[model samples]
Target chain A: MNQFIQELTKGLWKELPPFRLLLGLCPVLAVTKSASNGIGMGMAVLFVLTLSNMLISLVRNIIPSKVRIACFITISATLVVAVELLMQAYAYPLYLQLGIFVPLIVVNCIILGRAEAFAAKNPVHLAIADGLGMGLGFTMSLTFLGSIREILGAGTWFGYPVMWDGFQPFTIMVEAPGAFLCLGLTLAAMNYGTRRQLMKRNREGSEASASPCGGCRACSIGKSQD
Target chain B: MSVFEVFISAIFVNNIVLAQNLGNCPYLGCSKEKGVALGMGTSVIFVTVMATLCTWLVQKYILIPTGLEYLQTLVFILIIASLVQFVEMFLKKAIPPLYASLGIFLPLITTNCCVLGVTLLVQREQYDLMDALIYAFATGAGFLLALLLMAGVRERLETCRVPKAMAGTPIALIMAGIMSLSFMAFKGMV
Candidate 1:
């Protein structure tokens, strides 16, 4: 239970997909224009990630190492297609909004990265925990970013008017350029905060502040504690 | 639109990176150095054209005829994956210099959304063989242009001391935001 909890929490902050590892930026940037869209896309990713991770973990031993990448891509792509069909049938509005990005989820480096790195090595149950953690982390971040952009850029929150009419929205916040700027600022702030925490911990006899790693080294991901 | 207009529009007005957000991974990943950026750009162009052409043919003949348009995503990704692999091998054997320069980026192209995005867009827009070819070139060219610009800025940034808080991806992204804003000027040119 403790190990499962650890696997689940690791991807939340220690290895947040976009702000931390910087994988899967295309879908993050493209579909995160509104909170609803972000949630919709996030759920889609969660479905695909958790399922693919579980499936890959189950068959990890069977897949030949030589063609594992090809195998991973195929499995994920098929899952994405199924997700797309389900979305189209059930949630047509979101299905329309997401469009190509839904299909493009197959290529999201986060899924394949985990498949190769974590799932292929771990047992199925642990892989499920990791998948949920990463997927939910991705969801939270995307929704947060999307809501910020939507509120500032469109003067609304999830389509409801949040600001007074006199408030002139920074329309650029919703555009392509805005996506980059918003994400950049968030990353910078996160890195700065983590560095301060690291410094304080070092002062408290942690003695691990000799080198300030960006927390991006894949080998050391989810190692939040010394 | 004329081919020239299409080319210009693709390059500036509807940029693959900024406007369409098609290829942010490699745009940021490969933009650290100008030379590598160019190499990746050329490889993307080659693969985009090749992938677009092959997928376009398949969509028209195989998927559309059989009423399997829903399988476009699955099939296009497979085509793109194999296409990138084949192109990588071909470049390695035939054009070693280019291959050496490309390095890991060549294989990375397999999952690049831009390659698949181009094929999907071409199919969506229903471009003919010739127009699709031009579009493949234009989309790749546009991506290259954005990448080059970003690389030039990043190179200059390395010389100057950046603020501690905004170094790396943050500053790169802010720079991209400014560039995207500038590209917005070309909005109505087409």
Candidate 2:
């Protein structure tokens, strides 16, 4: 149980696919012109990831090593197809909006990366949790990016108007250039926060050591405690 | 559109790399050296042409006829993955120098969106066989052009003192944004 929580939580932040790990940016940038588009793409990825992870985890032991990658690709591709069909049937608008990105999701490194790295070695239940948690994390991150871009670029969220009258939106923010700007700024923000935490930890460690009677004495004490 | 027009338009008007913004992972990640970029471009051109032809055949003969368009994505990916493998082996056997140049990137081609994007775009536009082939080749040329230009710029960027915050991918991304903006000038050409 604890292990499941740990695996799932890691992908949300510590090993996030886009923001942290920077695994899959092609789709992240391409389909995030609108908030609804982001949500639509994210949900599709979540479904594909969770199912692929579970199935890959279950069959990890049975699959031969030489053929594992091909197997994983096949499984992931199958799930992507299933999701693509379901979306086309039920959400034709989003299906059209997402366009080729839906099919391209099959090649997304995050899903394949998770399957090969974590899911293949873990139990089915743990894989399931990790998949869902990571998927939701990816979805939320994209949706947040989309909301910012959509509202600023078009003065709207999704397709509806959100800004006050007389506001002139930045056209580039909603286009291909806008995608780069949003993603770059978001990455910088994440990097800045991470750097701050690292600096803070170092400061606290140094302060703790310096406050002691002696450096050697403190080091010895810490070692003994450990 | 005529075959020449399709070819010309793909190469300039609707370039996969510049206009469509597909396969950006390699564009940003690998476009540091001109030699590498050229090698990567050659590989992309080869794989994209083959993948498009393969998908075109599959779509025309199998998926559309069988009413299995939903499986198009799955089938395309499988074909691409295998085709990449075959190309890798063929390169190693026939041209070791080219193989060395394209070494690791050949495998990465599977995930490079430009290959898949070309396949998808060809299908979406419903191009005839000649049109599909021309578009695929021209799109590959466009991608190569963008990558080479990006690499040339990056080679010089290494010496210039960029802002500390925007030193790496951030600055590269900003440059890409500018490039994308410039590419917008060619939008009405079609």
Question: Which candidate gets the maximum lDDT versus the true structure?
Answer: 1
Q: After superposition, how far is residue B28 of candidate 1 from its true place, in Å?
A: 1.2
Candidate 2 CAPRI level: acceptable
Against the unseen true structure, what C-alpha lDDT does each candidate score? 0.86, 0.82
TM-score of chain A of each: 0.92, 0.88
Residue B167 displacement in candidate 1 (angstroms): 1.1
- Where in model 1 is the C-alpha error above 4 Å? A203-210, A213-226
Cand 1, B chain, TM: 0.96
lDDT of 1 at B103: 58
Which runs in model 2 stand beyond 4 Å of their true positions? A200-226
For candidate 2, list the clashing residue pairs, or say none: none
Q: What's the distance in Å from true for residue B8, model 1?
A: 1.8
lDDT of 2: 0.82
Cα lDDT tens digits for candidate 2, A40-121:
9999999999999999999999999887878998999899888877987899999998888998888887888788778899
